[model samples]
Every structure is written in structure tokens, then in C-alpha cells.
Target chain A: MKFGVLRFPGSCDDVDALLAARRVGDAELLWHGERDLKGADAIVVPGGFSYGDYLRAGSIARFSPVMESVIAFAGDGGLVLGICNGFQVLCEAKLLPGALLPNSNLRFTFRQVELEVVQEQTAFTCACGLDGPSPVVLSIPAKHSWGRYYADEQTLADMEGRGQVLLRYAPGHNFNGSSNDIAGVSNERGNVFGLMPHPEHAVDELTGSKDGLCIFASMCLAVEAARV
Target chain B: MKARVLIRPKAGILDPQGEAVQRALPALGFEGVANVHVGRMVELTVEDASQIEPMCQKLLANPLVEDYEIVLDT
Candidate 1:
């Protein structure tokens, strides 16, 4: 599988995503201005202070040229993952529902966090074998001021009914005051996934945890499964 | 024309910054602060009045989380 990681101006984690993608599949850095997806099987929008977080995080980056292709790719059921600032971009782009708000503490939060797999059947979490008995907990890093997720009550209920909530801060550890403790969510079609934590940053032993590799591995498995 | 745009988090949404300020006010000897909410303002020189709403909808405010008003400076 080939992965295209988008690089918008001021994007900080694109390289980390590229490194993570390289470990799982063929990875390429895709510039924001590029109109095409470069034949990539999956697209990853990495984190960063895109557009210097002006006019709200991910708001300006949503209008980048490459996003047009990303939107089209998602519309075609292609796998798309947006991490951290990328999550904001996805919400701003309307590919994902809800909006990211400032942390309830009124401060930037950065640390290792445990995320519970709420919806394991999706392409992004299948590697955890969620259908098996035990719950899957990922040790990943969450970093950002605007990581609290918010949606209207009805939308939240609908997402719950449809199994769109993909990840949440582990019980009693909801650090950012996210509504429903939502750390990640996928679109109704399950083709697009967005998360506040940095999975790419945890894909290696040197980072003290390889828990994040399962997410990338899950995508690889999904791609292979689709090929059959 | 000069246009001023005010963007605020929706009423029902949590405003941590505003809450922080409200909490700090009592310590600073201010009393009877019923409620506090924070918002941002942007002043722009626009060529046309028609562009203001689109600007608010597209960039200045996220309709999902914010409400924005555009006022022209006469």
C-alpha cells in the first residue's frame, strides 16, 4: 500500500507520519498545493500548527488545494486518517463532524495518554482484534491546546447510534474535557478517521511504545483484505 | 469600506478562557460578575459588503462552534 502524507505550511508532524508510513508501506510527502493524490492508496494528514493556527486551528488549511483531492478521495471510500492538527483540518473540511475546542483547563496539554477503542470494527482499529474478548487500550501521546471535541447533542446521539465514535480518553483520564471524552471519530461511511492524539509519534520502541503501529497496521490489513 | 467582525463561541459551548476570567475576577475584588464569555474581533478593509458574510462563514467563524457578526464602520 502507498500512503500519501500531506504537508501543509507549518505542519510539524508530517515527517513523523512519513516515517511511520514508511515502516508500514510506501510513503510519500504530498504538498498542500498538489491537486492529485499521487496514486496513493491511503492519505494521512499529519499534525502541526497549520497556517499558524490562525482563524482557528485547521480552518485555513482546509482550503489548501490538496484538500480538494483529499475530499474527492474520501468521497470515493478511500481510507483517510487525520492526526492532531489534521483532525482539526478534517472537521474544518467537513469530512468529519464536530469541532475541536480549547482544553477546559485553558492551557496547552502535552503528555502520554491512554485511548480506549470504542469502535473496533473500522479499518483503523481492526489490528487490535477488537472482536476478541478484551478491550484495546493504546498508549499514545496527546498534544495540543485545542483538542476538546464538541458536537451538538443530537449529532452526538446519532454518532453514538451509528458507531461513529472511534476512540475516547480512557475512563477517569479525560484530560482535555472533550464532550463524551471523544479523542477520535470516524465519518458515517467509516472511510475517514480523525484523532487528536499522535499515533505516529508512538510507532516505535525508541519512543517507549509501539502501540501506535497497530493503527497503521490495521490500515495495511484493510488494504490487503480489500485486494482479495 | 471597513468592516469589523466579532466571532464568539456558541452560547452552549464551553468557554474555558471566559470561565478562567470569570473565576479570576472575584479574586481581583470585582463582585457580582454574573457571567463572562470571551470572543474575538477582526477589523478588515473590504472592497465589497457582499464578501463579509462569506468571509465569516468560510474563515472568520466556524459555524459549528462559533457565531459571527459583521458590522460595517461608517
Candidate 2:
């Protein structure tokens, strides 16, 4: 599988994502201005302060020229993963439901966080062993000022009914005051996934945790599963 | 035409910045402060007045968690 990691101006984690992708499969760096995805089977929108987080995080990056192709790629059923600011961008682009609000503490939170795999049936979490004995917990780093997931009651209800909520902060560890402790969510089709934590940052053993590799591995499995 | 847009978090959506400011006001000796909701103001030069709403809907504000008001400057 080929992974395209998007690089936008002010994006801080593009390199990290590229390295993470390289560890799993062939990876390429995609520019924000390019209208093509370079035939990537899956795309990863890496974490960063895209557009310097001006006018709200991910708001400006959503309008980048490459996003047009990203939208089309997703519409064609290609897998897409958005991490940190990428999650904000996906929400702004309307590829995913709900919005990420400022943290309730009004401070930038940067630390390793525990995430519970709420739904592992999706392409992004299938490697977490959904049918296992207990919930799969990942030690991933979440670094952001606006990471609180929010949505209206009806929309939240629909998301819950559809199994769209993919991950939540483990019980009693909700750091950002996200509603329902939502740490990540998937699009209705489950092909698109967005999460606040930086999975790429946690993929290396040198980073003290390799738990995030499962997320990328899950994408590889999804791609192989689709080919069957 | 010039338009001024005010975008704010919707009611019931948490506004941590505003809450922080509200808490600081009393400590700073300001009294009678009930609540504070911080919002953003955007100024735009547009060709048509009618385009303002669409701009708000498309980019200026996310209707899911924010509400935007547009005022045209004559």
C-alpha cells in the first residue's frame, strides 16, 4: 500500500508522518497545492499548526487546493486518516462530523494520553482486536489547544447510533473535556478517520511507545481486505 | 461592498477562553460581570452583499458549533 502524507505550510508533523508511513509501507509527501494524490491508496493528513492555526485550527488548511482532490479521493472510497490538526481540518472540510472546540482548561495540552478503542470494526482500528478480552488501550501523545469534540444532541445521537465514535479517552482520563470523551471519530462510511492524538509521534519504540503502529497497520489490513 | 462578520461559539458549546476571561475580571476588581463569550470578527470586501451569508456558511463559520452575523457597511 502507498501512503500519501499531506504537507501544508506550517505543518509540523509531516516528516514524522512520513517516517511512520515508511515503517509500514511505501510513502510519499504530497504538497498542499498539488491537485493530485499521486495514486496513493491511502492518505494521511499529519498533525501541525496548518496556516498557523489562524481563524481557528484547520480552518484555512481546509481550503488548500489539494483538499479538493482529497475530498474526491475519499468519495471514491479511498482510506484517509487525519491526526491532530488534520482532525480539525477534516471536520472543517466536512469530511467528518462535529467540531473540535477549545479545551475546557483553555491551555495547550501536550502529553501522552490513553485512548480506549471504542469501535474497532472500522478500517483504522481493526488491528486493535475489537473482539478481544478487554478494550484496547493506546498510549498516544495528544498535543493541541483545541481538541474538545463537540456536536449537537441529535447529531451526537446519530453518530452513536451509527458506530462512528471510534475512540474515547480512557475512563477517568478525559483531559480536554471533550464531550462524551470522544478522542476520535470516523466518517459515516468508516473509510475516513480523524483523531486528536498524534499517532505518528507514538509509532517509534524510541519515542517510548509503539502502540500507534497498530493504527497504520490497520490501514494496511484494510487495503488488503478491500483487494480480496 | 464591505462586510463585518461576527462569529461566535453557539450557546451551550463550551467557551473556555471566555470563561477564563470572566474569572479574571472579578480578580481584576471588575464587578457585576455575569458571563463572557469570546467571539471573532472578520472584515471582508465582497462584490455582492448576498455572498456574505454563503461565505459564512462555507468558511467563515462552522454552523455545527458556531453562529455568524454579517453586517454590510454602506
Which candidate should be chosen as best, given TM-score against the real structure?
A: 1
| TM, every model | 0.97, 0.96
Q: Write the per-residue lDDT of candidate 1 for residues B1-74, one digit (tens) a residue.
A: 99899988899898888888999999999999966889999999988989999888888899999988889999
**Compared with the true structure, what per-residue lDDT tens digits does model 2 show for residues A35-67?**
989989999999999999998899999999999
lDDT of 1 by residue, A1-228 (tens): 999999999999999999998888999999999898999999999999998999799999999999999999999999999999999999999999999999888788889999899888889999865444558888899899999999999999999999999898998767889989999999999989999999999988888887888888889888889989
Q: Best candidate per DockQ, number?
A: 1
DockQ of each: 0.93, 0.84
* Fraction of native Cα contacts reproduced by each candidate: 1.00, 0.87
Of candidate 2 chain A, the 10-residue stretch with the lowest lDDT total is A127-136
Name the weakest run of 10 consecutive residues (lDDT summed) in model 1 chain A.
Answer: A127-136
